[model samples]
Target: MQDEVDAVQRILSALADVGLDSITFVAEMSSTGRSVLHLLTFGPAVEAGIGPYPGSLILVEGAVPEPWRRRPHPVPRAAPAASVDAALLERTLRERIPDATGATEAEIAAAEAWLGVALPDELKALYRVTRGRWQDWGDDYAAAERVAQAVGCELFPLDELYVASALSRPCPWRFAATEAVVSPPDAAVQGLVGSPGWIVFGDNGGGDRIAVDLTPGPRGHVGQIIMLDHEQNIGASLLADSLTNLVVHQRGDRQSSYRVDQPTAVARVNIQSMTSIQAAAHPGLEVLSIGVWDGEPLSLAPVTGLPRLRTLTAYPGTLADPLEIAKLSGLEYLELGPEEWRVLLDAGAVPRTLSAAGIEVHGNRHPLPIVALANELLALWDRPPISQTILEGHVEV
Candidate 1:
């Protein structure tokens, strides 16, 4: 690892020699026989299927990843349950694991006090049967497996129970801005990265979490079991109506599935998605990403004056007029090539409305100009500038 770090320092030093402070490496599964982690899985992977912190983390230091900055748009909870059949749930667990020991009433109350919310009676009943700690089962794998099978998930301990706060799941800016939280009118589970009301109490064997949904969707029952997929950065799926249903019935509808490809919410004017910016234009469009184009440079006139367009990411030389970006009044995030940024900076056309921006460096570009441009954008917001630490040394390849 130290050798690898040294090599990176050497590369960065070489880049600095060419007036560059940072670079983003591309990932591919092509001619090279060697396999490296790319936009696909190898081991632990980014939920968005992108290389971690893609588009260069080096220069974006002062900028916080968008996820930590994101606020969950308000989601009104459905009415609470009149009551839960705690006795039935307790009977069911005892039948499944006859020797299981449960959490004390005091322990459960302590958890509620720590989380600042009363847990449903159904959840409390489950804990009363088995605390679900490894220590409770000791080194007996069979005992642990029996409990997991009985509960339909590997349960978290009473002390470990936590509110799956949305702030807990932070993603890079490029990805966080692209996702949308969707809970259909008839859905049982609400789509969100995290929620204070989601009392996470178990795991689905994989990294995905199993939680008791205190804030359910319009059609949902309070205290329904939900699974938050680890591979996804947002939302969850309905697993069961309650803990009793999960253990006894072993069935739960994976109720909600969210897709982010809304022409009104997100538009990709590129060869990979749609063909033209003109086609992507709409009043409700919030993000406009323009990618590789070999034909004529496109005009931003198609999307000008769009009230909801808050993000615009254009590839190098894709914009016919970078100044056209200024016409986008609601833009909070903008990413452009150095040349395009230079155009905006030179004309004093940089939007004062922006909260965060990124510089897209393509090819063997000099870092000096990009660093300078990054500083200029940071200065606009009184943000701390990107600082480069110089290291001079010869690294053995």
Candidate 2:
């Protein structure tokens, strides 16, 4: 018995350095008096390569006291509190934006009835603080909206709460038919359709939408927010785990809700003014489509490190030389603007290994001039005259 107690004491002392907080032990003794002890320790320092749930268990040969087999006493706790504090959120919003106004209970109730779904408690708390609108707080706090707009959605609007509520019958605005030009395959389309309970609340002023997914796809969870890009052929990319997370994020909390398991063809979307840090974080990108609304010259230097980049769509002023982009051996598709195409053709620097190559020309002008030139230049290479419409009447080849 002395030996058994000494062994346990020594074991506890050894584990003290590892932050061991609690220990439970069990023992079994044979008729010959030999015994075995099983000790389970909680709050131990997790070892390298350990999984999310970490703990330690030790087995020692000894006769332990019967008291060791009993369960440990329960820990005490304080009274429960709301996960989100409505008054605190309101205070924060008022501090940041003096014009912020919270939604009234009647407004929230009406909106919920129109949508035919109850808002999650956290989201309800958020609305009670602020209806849905908040000014761009700054770079860090506004990163979500910036990333959403870059991918395809317009400014994240809180007015969506009221507008979506008004258009509740049949929910025409609930789903946007993806343009056939950038649509995913039938299976992927079916997967998206399976989760038809998406409520679009805002747009990019173009046509793309930002929505809260009530019925998530196979790889997503309900209540998660996603961006639906109708123009770029990209389907849904998760933006936040929940509306509550989005609100928390805007308060300068750095957490990622970006989910990347979409169909490969429409999986990647480009962000304007991308930095090397952002590119390294999204190494799974399959397509890099640059959009520069500022008309300032863009650079492809930041994305050269992407190991999985398969498609390169270079807008005007994005590249100084075609070879600078052709150097990426993994790139399978290349789309270039007129001037870049001319430079590449002139220098014979266009990589012949590309699966598809085309020139992109923007505007509503007669395609005869550009089409004739495209055929002349691309006919020898056996490529198609791929033209995309930037606007209702403006075509980009």
Candidate 3:
């Protein structure tokens, strides 16, 4: 679900207050030299490990009134509970990661030795996980957006984890993390049938990154997607070029294996995990979905690699190739995440095809409207034009 304008603004302001400044805005308005209230701070908040803080990470919404104002956004909230004991959790993690130890110094030393870099003073204050060989480091580890300037290390995106806390969602960390503990999804559990969309679970399935046997609910199925929670390796997963209906994985566990049971022609994968799904180019591939789990600054490559790729998930950050892909012969589906949707709507990129072969996104609510619009548009394209006026109305939050 999306965040309320006020909540986002307050969060952004807090980021700014914390001494972050270098920023990037990926909204449609940002491209047109316009502005949306949301902002993303980048670079080191400080320089030379000394004086004058560079800038703050501020994603503020402009002071718009009414509909444009920051409204309460919906999200999947978790049950409220006690905070995890940092010391105990630390020990548990140490046991799981092997290198992580109960002592902070040992863990810090291990991170430094493995990652081949010195830990920033501030970074040491929080938990640190090295990007393992098979790990993607997207969902599992919430990196700080703005790293310490002196270290010259890239800032990690930890906003998603923080947002989970603000919304009172389940601590994604508590999910089966260690390989020994994380078992494969049972066939009986295969497919989330009750869910509106297809869901794929990733586990300790070795080189087979995705375990697709989850049970589905009675509700209508939109399509299949995979969730690779940082266990599989990107290059290895792509090597199979299986193109399962959906893909999902987390970050920091790239070594995990992923497999594609269906042929590329049969399935269109939507990957929300930090890893990119477009491995080999296939003209038949319909959609390439991506999302920013927290606030990690990741890029989505255009179908430049995939000749058949038509629909692309709209996430924040600049596109490697927009015009080129816009000209794709049969390109159609283009949906945005909660963060990118507002920008897409404002940018007026909603093509007639958007009415059909539409994009799906994550929010507190369902996206039946987008699907309906796409169906209507496709119907109109085949026959005579139908009045789409009814859909022109704004969706009530």
Highest lDDT, which number? 1
Q: What is the lDDT of candidate 1?
A: 0.72
Off by over 4 Å in 3: 1-274, 277-284, 291-302, 314-327, 338-348, 352-397
lDDT of the candidates, in the order given: 0.72, 0.45, 0.30
Model 2 Cα lDDT, one tens digit per residue, 71-185: 2121122111233444454454455444335577787787778766776554465555445444433334464444343223344334455222212212111011111112222
- lDDT per residue for candidate 1 within 135-223, as digits (tens), equals 87887999999999888888888999989877667666666666555555666776667777799998988898999988777777778
Candidate 2 residue 273 C-alpha distance from true site, Å: 6.1
TM-score of model 1 relative to the true fold? 0.78
* TM-score for candidate 2, residues paired by index: 0.31
Q: Write down the lDDT that model 3 would get.
A: 0.30
Candidates in order, TM-scores: namely 0.78, 0.31, 0.23
Which model is ahead, 2 or 3, in terms of lDDT?
A: 2
In order of lDDT, best first, we have 1, 2, 3
**TM-score result, candidate 3:** 0.23
